[model samples]
Target: MRLSIISTHKRIQKGDIGEFEKLFRNLYSPLCHYAFRFIKDMDSAEDIVQDLFYNYWKNREKLEITTSLKSYLYQAVRNKCIKTINHQQVKEKYNNVLRLQGQDYDDYSSSNIETEELNQIIESTIDELPDRCKEIFVLSRYEGMKYHEIAQRLSISVKTVEANMGKALKMFRLNLKGYYQISANQ
Candidate 1:
């Protein structure tokens, strides 16, 4: 039976399955097609429309339609389509960040595993150095102290400071050559 918006809403609220089914048959396709225009996927569009109708049926007693039934259905589908698109974009961005943080690296910072591995190798190698050499190297490289400043701070000669730095550089180069090559290739 043909029904106006008011009559259809009243029937739905009264739990009249026949009239509600008629409204569903009349509106489902148009709403799905409208959603498809925004989301570009047939199955997702169909799901949005189906969920809308199912929620409408479940919440009929609390439903309020200030607009026509067609307008309400179309607007609901449009909002759902926008939400789906926004959600997909967020998921894609999250995956991209995960790729950057995980094994996949492309011109950005090195991956987490590579960075952590390098840090571990460097720390262990520095730890293996003579105490004075480690102290001089860390002050010079990590603390950004010049040779004279390091020598003054540690009460050593500039010659000794220079020697320690040279030794640290050689040790780092020999230890990290392979790791550096691997990261560079990646």
Candidate 2:
């Protein structure tokens, strides 16, 4: 039985749909439960698990699993949960800022103009960053990757990740501060 399962997995890895469904069926529920532990939300957990499987299938040509298949699935799900949590944190922060500012402006047109200006400034600042620094910053901030994970993915050291991130933040703060000051004066 174990040999047959291993053969099936290898076949799926080679793009065999019949074997892929068999392997997916065997692993789906367990992967969902694994994701639920990290996310604490059943529907989101299931979605994450489904996405992981889809990505795995899409990237099967480059897939390399040294450990058990279950371990690989769990790690993918964990990373996805981390990304989801980080996105929620950013949204919550934005909401809090809006709430404290009390969006009761009588001139909606002015407010919309200001919002567009701020967005453009932010986008321009991001575009002005050094290539590697911008990549690291986006991966860490937007993708919610930890320093070690970023380092591993980029084949760089953790110290390099930290240094680059610090530079990125400093540049953003300087640019964004100027943008806000100009907006306030207008």
Using lDDT as the measure, the top candidate is 1
Candidate 2 displacement at residue 149 in angstroms: 61
Give the alpha carbon lDDT tens digit for every residue of 114-156 in model 1.
7789899999889988999999999988999999999999998
> Model 2, residue 146: displacement in angstroms?
56
Q: Write the per-residue lDDT of candidate 2 for residues 1-186, one digit (tens) a residue.
A: 132425655787788998778778888898788888877899999999888888989988787777666666777888899999999788777666666787533344478887898888778878988999999999998899999999999999999999999998898899889777887797
What root-mean-square deviation over C-alphas does model 2 reach? 19.2
lDDT comparing candidate 2 with the true structure: 0.82
lDDT (C-alpha) at residue 139 in model 2: 96
Query: Top TM-score: which candidate number?
Result: 1
TM-score of 1: 0.53
